[model samples]
Target: MEPVAGSLLAPLLLAGAAFSNHLTDSYGATANYWAIGLHISCWIAQFVGHGIFEGRAPALLDNLVQAFFLAPFFVWMEILFLFGYRPGLQSRIAKAVEKEVDKFHQSKLHGNGRATNGKIIRTIASLALSLAVYKYAHGDPDKQPLLTRWLHYYDSMQEDFKRKTYMNIKFVEEAGKDRHLFETAPFVGHMELKFPE
Candidate 1:
């Protein structure tokens, strides 16, 4: 969310710099200096918001070219949400965003786990690593169980990938536990597993 807001505000800073150049041509050196200073200050504020307040890298650092254009449009949509517009699509968009974030975390774990050897050791290490990463990423105590369940699914998928076998996996959310049903092999039958939170 902070990344999105930072991305949205970035273009305003660019516009300010452009306006400062126009000021230099017409208004005088003093006006240009003030405009440039304002632009610099705002840029610093954006970085502080992202790095310090948000606890995440600014979106620009990840993809400078895309951030330059996308930030403003994203902010516009956020503004609409704030105004209670598009109420119906909010949950759908939120779920999609959650999936993307989960995918990113899973990929990060996979990348870090590649250095380790041995299937059992790697699986155990990856599970621990994923739990730690998810905990840090979420920062909400109540969501720990959900994160654990997500890591369980992720671990299963990792195992399936290594075996070069496709598994039909289905996730069911229940009151007391999260259940994952995996059809490992057609003739072998289905495996029902419950991951502890």
Candidate 2:
């Protein structure tokens, strides 16, 4: 248990730090869109890594969470496309909504202009979304067990990546802030696995 737990400590800490940074950095305005987008990308990446690269099934909890995160984007996209065709819906509104979508389009026509912006926006949106999910999921210590269990699943699946006994634990010193520090931990150190993957 010590070695297995140690293997997860560093990555979990790193994920917590990264998640904190993401939440704090996008706390206001249109930044939430960017944060959610980034999280969506991460979900997709993890899904691909687990299903394709790792040749394993992704944890059911993770898949459920990913679906939850994607629900907003899918609904929003549908709304945008729907309003795009409605008569007398302000042309400006349509254009603005369309602009949001332009970012998702391939660069075959414009040579990577919109795609780059879209990538940036989506990344931020994804992060913001993840922060919200984390907050909700972690809102109660009782609920945290479910998340921790999912993390355990994710970590267990990553056994192939485990290499050493030494671990670096990352933790958020502040909520919704970018302050974080990593602490070296022995295999037997006290550390909670948050986001092992």
Candidate 3:
């Protein structure tokens, strides 16, 4: 609707602007007055249509900026859409909008619109994804449950970390020469460095 309206009106408006300098001041004022009148009439018509036909209010009432500015930008994009511009992106956007609208209506009908179970849903998705990856890498999960296999994977990760940090652990001499340094450490907390005197 917007693209069609713009395509029809834009050329005439541009032509009027181009020729306006040739017109007398009174004529230009008349044209401006006529344009304003048409705008107001169209706005009223829109309100009537929304009230009678659509059974809902215009989004202009909700957001003037979105209705006036963003709407024309979208209309321009729609005009370009006729030239096969980002068709896949447009369809994906349409699908996502449809999905969101459906979710909104469902939520409104059921109860509040508050986002519920989002964390639980994410945890379930992550667990399911990990389980699938685990099965792909290590065969059937039925043989050795997801958590059990996950624990084995976790143990290997800890082993890797321990290997990387091995330099931090003080090693005793073969005959336990520096064993005294190790024993002088507190039962808990930091140990005083026992340098050989």
Candidate 4:
């Protein structure tokens, strides 16, 4: 909540500094210099909070574009939570966010191979789907049914990916014994799943 509040308030303070600079004649330069210093200090503090306290890189490092727009909205949501709004869903949302952050940090500690594997799997699946779509669009009328079936299968696979929250390569070891789990599991393309002999 502190971070969220800071995110909301910092910009307004900086804007005030700018307005002050614009209003003053001789002191305008001094005001601009102080404003710039304060802005840089705030950013440095944010970085320290993320790296030292949170033990993770700030979200802005990953997505500056989205962060610019979402930060205020996120702060608003935090404000609502503080006021006891969204009582039922807020806890769930908080837990999910915490889990994701833990996973992200764990992946970082584990050398990021899991992250790369996930990306590779997604890329291959995307390529396969794109190829299927292209062939379906360009192929003969008689085989259209087969192509449509193939597309539908991939679409279902995508839906399965979306439906499951814990879809990761770590689940592959258990997926063989629990075939039903695999139905909703994320497909890691080209990874062979083997059971104990």
Query: Which residue runs does candidate 4 get wrong by more than 4 Å?
Result: 1-27, 113-197
Per-residue lDDT of 38-88 in model 4, one digit per residue for the tens? 765776577567656765556665576656767756776777689886677
RMSD of each: 27.9, 24.8, 27.4, 28.0
lDDT of each: 0.60, 0.53, 0.62, 0.65
**Model 1 whole-model lDDT (C-alpha atoms):** 0.60
Error of 4 at 36 (Å): 1.5
Tens digits of lDDT, candidate 3, 133-168: 746744653565343455558769999999866744
List residue ranges in candidate 2 displaced over 4 A: 1-106, 143-197
Candidate no. 1 TM-score: 0.37
Q: Per-residue alpha-carbon lDDT of model 2 for 1-197, expressed as tens digits?
A: 12533453558658978886576455632344465568668886865575456333344333666556554444544554475533454465568868855653434345755644554455556557866876775576565434455555766767634533223122222421442223333356687879777
Ranking by lDDT: 4, 3, 1, 2
- Residue-level lDDT tens digits of model 1 in 103-124: 7577656674443223335444
Candidate number that wins on lDDT, 1 or 2:
1
Error of 1 at 170 (Å): 83
Best by lDDT: 4
